[model samples]
Target: MRKNRNLIVLNIIVILGALVMVFPFLWAFITSISPGAGLSSTPQLIPDNPSLSAYVQLFDRLPFGKIVLNSLGLAVLTTGFQLITSSLAAYVFSRMPFRGRNVVFAVYLATMMLPMQVLVVPLFVEMKTLGLIDSYLGVLLPSIASAFGVFLLRQAMNSVPTELDQAATLDGAGHFRIFGLIVLPLVRPALATLTVFSFLNSWNSFLWPLIILRTPEMKTLPVALAGLQGQFTTQWDVVMAGSVISILPMLALYIFTQKYIIQGVAGTGLK
Candidate 1:
């Protein structure tokens, strides 16, 4: 009877926590469908009259399709480049033998500690020097290589048995051949995790794109969403609608790769 009581209490607690977490998304969805709704001190959980007018008006008010395409293009390129660069760098760190390798990797790892704010000015200057300002390449330049991605993938690679690489080497297999045909297939969960992370970071990026992109046509989703807010008056409903639309792609990706995320995270520490 005591155990049953404890289980009931635990279940109730979990249910309450879940509700608290889901409330904001529920409110956003409700607000998106309630046209002309302003943010309230006490937000209404349910709308009296729900309408899709805000969603319609969202596309009408802005060139959101262009913005979305820009974001998608940038994100896809950034994620792809990160995966390739990070995997190569990680393989070197994990498998290659050289002088000062640990020191070099340590320096690389230290970079992840530095916030993006510190690099913005120098990156902007470099972009300006290359005449890449106001271009997608300018926005993409910094994200192509990721320290966190390298660290994650290196840790994953370390968990793989060195015997496999040794056997491949004895068989006259090159590093590229072994990496492509052997190691990569084994660490798929880690790659999936990195893919999700890289995509999310690029998709939700606001500051860099805002600083680099000057034209309306080049604006990404977050920047375009920011435009929905007025200096003195804001449209809560349309903004909420935009929020919903922006999250759909990410949500879908996560749903499909959810299993890998857990496995990757848990396995990364095993090395």
Candidate 2:
């Protein structure tokens, strides 16, 4: 009976926590639909007169479709490149035997500690030298290799049994063949988690794109959303609408791959 009471109390606390977490998003959506809704001290979850006027006005004021397409393209390309590069690097770090392997991996892991701000000037200079400044490549080149992704994937790969590799070797399979046919399939959950993470990071990235992309056409959603704020006055409803639209892809992606993310994260152990 004591255990049951504790469980009930825990359940109630969890339910309330869930509500608290969801309330802000609910308020944002309500504000988006409530035409001319200003920032309120007490936010309403339900608008008395809900409408899509803010959403309509948002598109009218900004080329949101093109911006969305640009963000989507950059995100897709960044995730694709990171997946390839991270998987190959992770495979090497986890599976290969070499002198100074541990030291090299440690050095690579240390790079993740460096803040991106510190590298911006040097990266920009390199892009300028290559004439990639103000282009998608400029925004993308730095993101193609992800240290976090490598660490996560390497951890996942470590969980895979070496016996499988030996069996594949006995079957005359090379390292590349084992990687493609044996290892990748075993780490599908980790790959899915990485894909979601890479997509989210690329989609929401602001500073790098702001520095690298010069034209309005190349602007990403976050930078474009920031533009909605005026020097003097801002439209809260329109900003809220843009916020709603911006979160949709991430929400959909999280809902689809949340299981994999949970599984992958739980299974991975730092080695």
Each model's lDDT: 0.93, 0.93
RMSD of 2: 1.4
Query: What TM-score number comes out for model 1?
Result: 0.95
lDDT of 2 by residue, 140-188 (tens): 9999999999999999999999999999999999999999999999998
Off by over 4 Å in 2: none
lDDT of 2 at 130: 98
Q: Give the alpha carbon lDDT tens digit for every residue of 1-271 in model 1.
A: 9999999999999999999998888888888998788887356767778899999999999998998999999999999999999999999999998999999999999999888899899999999999999999999989999999999999999999999999999999999999999999988999999999999999999999999999999999999999999999999999999999998999999999999988999999733
TM-score of each model, paired residue for residue: 0.95, 0.97
